[model samples]
Target: MLDDEARRALSRWTVGEPNAIREYAHGAINQTWLIETARGSYAFRRCAQGGAEVVRQNHRLIGEAVARGVPTVAPVVVEDGNTVVVESGRVYALFPFAAGVQVDRDRLSNNDIQAMGRSLADVLEALRGCDRSLVKEGRYEVCVSEAIREIDRLLSVISELPPGEPSDENALERLTTRRAWLVEHGVEDGDPFADFDRQPIHGEFQDRNLFLGDGKVSCIIDWDNASWSPPEWEVAPFLDFVAAYDKVKVAAFLAGYRARCKLPDERLDACVWAYGLYRAHDLWLFREVYDRRNDKARRFLTPGRFKPHFERWLRR
Candidate 1:
């Protein structure tokens, strides 16, 4: 959306003509753009229609993270130094361009992949230090309970999904059983361990949002989904790759994560099961909504191509 207003904002911030402008709204949520000014490139994000406070809190969190030595995009508050600027009824923030390469499966190495886990742990620890009281509370978009329930809903529709293979049916059944377990006995809040656990999160953590440079994680972009939530709850996305990549990669990730953040003994062993049923199921939903609909990758979703990769990822 490189309109006159956005260009004016860019000019006001950078104080120069933008050489180039790129729009990147690939995520299902929020609006994003990149502007290349004569001075430098800048990243821009406009909050979703219903999410003004979320972006405001995220701006506070970004500043807090910077103060704590964490890598993240800093929000450009309005002219008045407010975290968000409402223009034409849309909320937007401009940030200094981050330095790094977007991570992909092909570009990731054993160590490079493992580093992401460590980086996640660092983000968690730093987030803990931030004043959680400043973070707005209520209806966190990525809460575990709500996420698990959505997976259960997906499982209910699994069999009805165009009559796929028997294994697909079995996959849904296993996931459903797992969800039932969670609803029945898993921690439903009010535990000491749950202190920082259900605090805040980046919400969606994956290769897409991660960036690497100079042999280390330079920045973790896309703060629109950052919310108060659990710590390792951030790791679910990398664990989702089990359906497409080898277990060794997933292991490398967790090994790095454990080095920084340790899952409780009870949650550790079961976290792997989460490594399986619930997490796997949610990724499938993500794939249906994300990959299958992507204009560039739409053809990959034939009658039954992605399931085997999911199964194969699991066997490994």
Candidate 2:
């Protein structure tokens, strides 16, 4: 529930009389609310993670993409001609609610998968034309030493935990196994694809951010992670989605993407490798569970959550 002060602040926008405002629980980082008004329902979001500058940049890029025929919802301009309203150090913005369903990976048909791929390609192609000055350069470098040290630190923490749940035990096993894999594979530092050009991409392109309707992507939301990076970084999530390395589905997705833009097989392979290395070094889930004491992340602690994906990427 929003306090009267916050609600009054949001009223400055031209959205209309607010009939209802309810907290939206789906978002992990930003605080969101479904605001119902006489005109229409809107998604009111408080920029939680990034500051006002990021919110403004995202709005600019989203506006650019929408203008270029990308399927996405844009922020509504406020009374001050700005898309976002800064109230007491908090930034808030409203977007017309995008109505669609979020489909799981297994439930997606080949056509749906292909459409998903095509839609992503369309978004990338559209944003690629934007002046690079509008966005910040994205990071492509990988540091194995830091990851190794973090793994060791996590292992040390796990060692102190009193023997209890299977989750703790699983964490121990995963940490040790990942450390060994890092050494055996000789995971090195620095960006392998430094020679490639970087462009603006949807940083967190995944199932949750994508919405489906009528067997096609209705809207691609959450431009918060948008940045300038190698185009292949966006494609890595699809590799993880097509579990067990299902070549047919992979081929369908790639074909769909290729239909809209040029993604050579060699470049795609390199991107997947880069994504795999990222997964191997990623400790956010562990950090959330142990460091932040976030229990919600425990469900993803299953044994096959990461190893299978990493192994598949290796084979590719």
Candidate 3:
């Protein structure tokens, strides 16, 4: 249920305010609405408190890229020349809906992986050229030492997981074995941050953020997690999805990435450990939440997703 006052304020704030019929696209920690206006169907997102800061950086990055002719969504500037407006204690901004196709599991490919790697490298390079202050830094750092600390957090969480929720027998063993192996072997020099290129990274540069059209990365969306971090961290997603089938695709992505940013072998090689534990914990976290819901996602509360995946990794 929305109101006229909210609509009028939004109209005064953005290009297509009045005739812009809006519908909820998502209503999570923040609110994202699809607004159809004379300007076109654009995305209007509202965030309060901490979200305001992130929206600022999101708009700044998009504006910077558009100004440089790099392909990205442009935030709509209001008649008052502000790209964002705060009204009734909420921060709101409108962005042109990014063009391209939604990526699906079946759409994964070596070419797509390589293209993803290349596009991230290109966008990072573009971001590096801007005034660094426009991008804000967060409290935590991504480093090998830091990664180990995060692993420790995951292990402690594992120890405290609800009694019946551990992985399936095979997956449980694989998780234990890999965790032990990583604890012993992964602490060496092969972290991606060693001599890494730094930037205002589109922090979550996974395939879901990629909008592909006609065989290229048409747009990267969802700046919710954008942060200033080593560009090498962008290597994780391409590695995670593709390494399930072709390790060579990860290799191709790295090769394409090197053409733009020269990363240390340590960081590139660390993709395996980084991606492995990342998926393990990420899947575990998803299960934790999904198990509490009534949706079909509850089917994943068991080891169905992890057993085969972990077994395959063990065979490799």
| Candidate 3 accuracy as TM-score | 0.67
**What are the per-residue Cα lDDT tens digits for candidate 3 across 128-155?**
7676666666323233454445545545
Stretches of candidate 1 above 4 Å error?
Answer: 8-14, 136-196, 242-245, 264-266, 272-314
Instruction: Give the Cα lDDT of each candidate.
Output: 0.62, 0.79, 0.60
- The C-alpha TM-scores of every prediction are 0.69, 0.86, 0.67
Candidate 2 weakest ten by summed lDDT: 302-311
Q: Of the candidates shown, which would achieve the greatest TM-score relative to the real structure? A: 2
Greater lDDT among 1 and 3 belongs to 1
**Alpha-carbon RMSD of each model:** 6.4, 2.8, 5.9
Summing lDDT over every window of 10 consecutive residues in candidate 1, give the lowest-scoring window.
Answer: 300-309
- What's the number of clashes in each of the models? 5, 0, 2
Clashing pairs in 2: none
Ranking by lDDT: 2, 1, 3
lDDT of each residue in 172-279, candidate 1, tens digit only: 655665566556644433322232346666666677877888767889877656666655556654665421446678778878888987776467444444333333
